[model samples]
Target: MSSFVLVDRPVPEVAVVTLNRPDRMNAMAFDVMVPVRDALVELSNDNSVRAVVLTGAGEGFCSGADQENAGRAPHVEGLGRPGFGLRSLELLEDVVLALRRLHQPVIAAVNGAAIGGGLCLALACDLRIASSTAYFRAAGINNGLTASELGLSFLLPRAVGSTRAADIMLTGRDVGAEEAERIGLVSRVEDPVVDAAVEMGQRIAGFSQPGIELTKRSLHAGMAASSLESYMPSEGLGQLYLRLLTDNFEEATAARKQGRAPQFRDGR
Candidate 1:
């Protein structure tokens, strides 16, 4: 827990991860995530580490994947290992699951601009307490990336509502900390993410472990993954799977390129 990741293995098992790449606004690269996933797994398993807090070292939380790494639509491939693959999206899922699977408490101390994948970091936390200056954004849509990618597709709606999630994520707009609180995306509004996270950690540490763990699981258990089956598909799919089956996908992309709203051919 102390080596690969910066660890302060104190009582109640409070571990903090500084995204460590403030140089590019804490932009995430493969190297950064390896340590991040390692940190998450290490702290999660250590019995002494009862709680975990994630934050960035610089001015931003995380800004998603390295732009140089971006490429075509998700296509799975095996990385030679049985379960491990080199697919970018699959690894993203791995990171998300690692955060979710941890029995110990996890919190996001949003210190600054949590944009793109950075915003997803906040979403990953069991609770998010943002600094007054923190910003929540979804820049993926602006780059032709799916907001659904990086678990945002599933997490945002649960934090807010399906409609509101779509509005922000699809529009690639930034939401302020106050607005995040207003829309029910965050639990606290304050500065110094580490301090806020530690305060919450101390409070929860007073509780029994199982009770805390179960409550956390129960709270987050069913969130994520938009099942269009229950949704009214008339609105939009963000050029989802169905759109790619025909020329409508091209139409949707063209509209976005033209700086206009997508016009799906099917009225309903």
Candidate 2:
């Protein structure tokens, strides 16, 4: 079969990747992670894809790694030998990195449990839209693993500030959808998160592809840009590049006057 991830184009420029294997609560097994990585890379390279929504197949988003296969050797089924000393762990890291490094914006439609590595996956996305039933936890600490694996330590603090991130990570407590929305972990909490995410993705996909991609890159870079002075150079460069190199601004102007959506290439 095709492994645990199901990739589909629900809209012209929006790709929705569903985490299959609802029986395991969409756990990240070796098979699942590898295919997910490949799918993400494929989508990232597709110029027609402008946005992506990552969600679960059933009730849960993802409940971390497969507990049933906890004792299994960290090796791929078909591949001869896994790379690195911590092969499986590093592979999981690659999945998260792929999401962050993707040119298109990714939306995490958190439908249910997002614990341990699952939470890390959501955190890596550009945006998150959670369902009312959704809950987040850093259960790794409670289960004897370090609280801050999979870039959690870096992403959490930047998201909710040091105080909240420290408390959540240290305690390994559950944060419900309401609390998550209040704390800004998710922008919206709706009945069906995927629908909301798709709506947002469609809106984003309507904009100029290069504009959206450049904006995502600039925002990510600005997160570590130290000071406004340091960040302005990158921002200025993007604005200049867009103005001179692309016709998006002119298209936007015409669209605004014409009362219609701007067709990006050649400005229809």
Candidate 3:
């Protein structure tokens, strides 16, 4: 792993991936995000990891693609300008996809400035919690580029509605923590956002592994479902699969009768 990214276990089942470039506001330079993408892939294959929290080390989360010095993107060394641009973007796009495809749910602990690709990074997570001092911006427009990069175009509208997403992206304005929460861009605002995110991760980690994973899948599917009628059956099947293959439901019943929390042992 590069020194640009740090992976730590705040709790046994929760892995926190911190972008460590505090001086650059943890910009999405290739050096920083490549390790970040690799780290998520590593955590995805670790069965013991039930949830992941992504945040930055210092006062900012990520300032988008490094404007001052975007280190060389992997596999772009010999490419022509067009190929180089496409490959570089693909590398960053993979990082966003990695977050969504991870087996465990991901939470963005937005501790400070989440701008441009940074905002997209937060939106890619399954959930987001921000520090009171944190803020967000659609920085691409400000830089004379399209405001859509790294799935921000699709995810932002789904997150805060098309009208609001349009307004924010077109204007390239800063959204404070309170506004972020109010607009549904973040789940809540906390003083120490990373700790709050870890606590949420711990709570989620207590559930049946397959249950949580399936729920995460279903939630994402629900977002893209063409129709409720077609989506209902797949969702129902997931519930039945867990119920029949695991003793989680029975464990819950028994634990309820015993006046204690359920101890789910579904290894899957």
Candidate 4:
């Protein structure tokens, strides 16, 4: 295992990759991201491994891009790809996308305050299992980071409703695990992400690898056909669709008369 991952003893055939920077709240640095990407690729190739549980160490699952290396890409000496300026930081996002291509299921263990890119990290997983202590917030609006740096904007709306994504992104609301569960943002809420991930991974691993991989491919491809678009279309179309949904006069009337929040079923 690379230093970037605090590899736990395999839970039978499952591999748990932990972001090792506990002191920094498991923040991403260039050194870390590079190894993490490699670890993901390396682990995927290991025939002994059947599933992946990705998470971080300490009180934070991930705080987003490392402020120090915010604008840089990760590269080994003498290896650089042209036109891939954002590839270093975006490597993690690519790793997330690659999860669907793997023969095993990828589960996210979101244990703490996951902000900015951290939320995107969780979004990349096929299933997200958050701890009770977990809280989520978007960084693009609150901080100066672009929403697309990770996969936040693209994944958020689908995880929640697009309108809720707008409300969460524009307002930068810190969503706790209970509400996250209610909104279907998290598959389950457990005390620690590792336990949650392992429990789910065991269940998912019971399925045949090829069949599981195919299922993952179909699910992500659907998202790819939609969520992988550039931020402009994603943001604009999301807002437009949301506005159209909210424009239903009868629903609005019912919501007002009921004295409760509007219940828009086809939210995202």
In lDDT terms, which candidate is top? Answer: 3
lDDT of every model, 2 decimals: 0.72, 0.88, 0.95, 0.73
Clashes of 3: 0
- Candidate 1 has a TM-score of 0.74
Give the per-residue lDDT digits (tens) of candidate 2, residues 1-268.
2557999888888899999989889888877777888899999999888899999988999899788863333454555444433677778899999999999999999999999999999999999999999999998899998898899999988888899999999999999999999888899898778888989999998877778888999988988888999789889898888788778788889999999988877233
lDDT of 3: 0.95
TM-score for candidate 3: 0.98
lDDT of 2 at 263: 82
TM-score, predicted candidate 2 vs. hidden true structure:
0.92
Backbone clash pairs for candidate 1 read: 13-49, 13-50, 62-118
Query: Model 3 over residues 1-268: C-alpha lDDT tens digits?
Result: 9999999998999999999999999999999989999999999999999999999989999989898999888877778999999999899999999999999999999999999999999999999999999999999999989998888989999999999999999999999999999999998999788999999999999889999999999999999999999999999999999889899999999999999989998844
Clashing pairs in 4: 74-88, 162-268
Q: Candidate 4: where is the Cα deviation over 4 Å?
A: 68-92, 224-268
Candidate 3: clashing pairs of residues: none
1 or 3, which is superior by lDDT?
Answer: 3
Global local distance difference test of model 4:
0.73
- The list of candidate 1 runs beyond 4 A from truth reads 1-5, 10-12, 68-86, 222-268
lDDT of 1 by residue, 1-268 (tens): 3232465644445777777767766666666766678778877878666688888776877777667653332334534444443465566667788888888878888888888887887797888888888888888788886766668877888889999998998788889889988998888797666887887887777554554665666466434325545433422343343444445556667987999865544323
Positional deviation of residue 235's Cα in model 2 after best superposition, in angstroms: 0.6
